[model samples]
Target: MDFPETVRWTFAGLACLTLAALVREIRRLRRAEPGGRARVRWDAADQGAGLVLTVGGALGSLHLFGAGLVLTGVVLGGKAVRAVRARRRTTVGRPST
Candidate 1:
């Protein structure tokens, strides 16, 4: 497949991930039971990861359109690292029970 197809699939996948994560987070927050700091931390981590995915997808798509090719691997590699960092932050912060 060409850059266009690759970019399209990447964008679609990012959208799906965002949609699913958002739905899950909303459901978690909507529950009557109070959520502890850990839950909140994980939620925030998820949001941060979503941000990276969104930005990476947008940039990759733009480059693919304007430049006729995208460094999708590098762009997404950085984004994956960012997502890992966010998860680390969520886990590192100690939460009271």
Candidate 2:
């Protein structure tokens, strides 16, 4: 399948944005005080999933791989989102230090 140049560029742009967001989140996580082991694990998983998704998106646009990777990325991304929401709910009533 021939993808238009614009489609490729758009994917590239999204990949760049995802990378930036991943970096920012990592920095924030590092600065935060060590929390529960599960929270840390979830954050690490989220970062890993984001990286995979970004790569999948970029490769999909270039037609270097099939939609399988993209689908996997999407699934992982959804898990990350759910984990984050669950974490937030668990912490909502806690008082800030």
Candidate 3:
């Protein structure tokens, strides 16, 4: 089945957004003052705005652009959640004395 160009381009843009999100979150994750463990939060408004702008620029207002932006947002959001989960998992169930 052939996927719409909107969907395909959107998916690609979304992947790129996730990558950018990782870069941004990685910096924050490394810099965060750990109360217990470090968790990356990529849902920052700034990032969202950036996604909108990035996707918008990548795929103008051809309707597909909006879809691309939404996909990008989702990818970024998923990455954020996964990062936190990974941090939690790593910190949990350690061999205690």
For candidate 3, write residues 1-97 as lDDT tens digits.
2456776687568748756885776677667777522234444444554555555555544454465557667767777787788888997888757
Give each model's whole-structure lDDT: 0.58, 0.63, 0.61
Writing each residue's lDDT as its tens digit, candidate 1 over 4-88 gives 6577667768767776776767666666366354455456455545645554565554433333223334445656776798789
Better of 1 and 3 by TM-score: 1
lDDT of 2 by residue, 1-97 (tens): 4556776677678778767776876776777776654455455556555556556555553333344356556656766887789899999999999
Q: Measured by C-alpha RMSD in angstroms, how accurate is candidate 3?
A: 9.9
Q: What's each prediction's TM-score?
A: 0.40, 0.51, 0.37
Looking at model 2, residue 13 earns an lDDT score of 83
lDDT of 2: 0.63
Q: Pick the candidate with the highest lDDT.
A: 2
Leading candidate by TM-score: 2
Which of candidates 2 and 3 is the stronger one according to TM-score?
2
1 versus 3: better lDDT goes to: 3
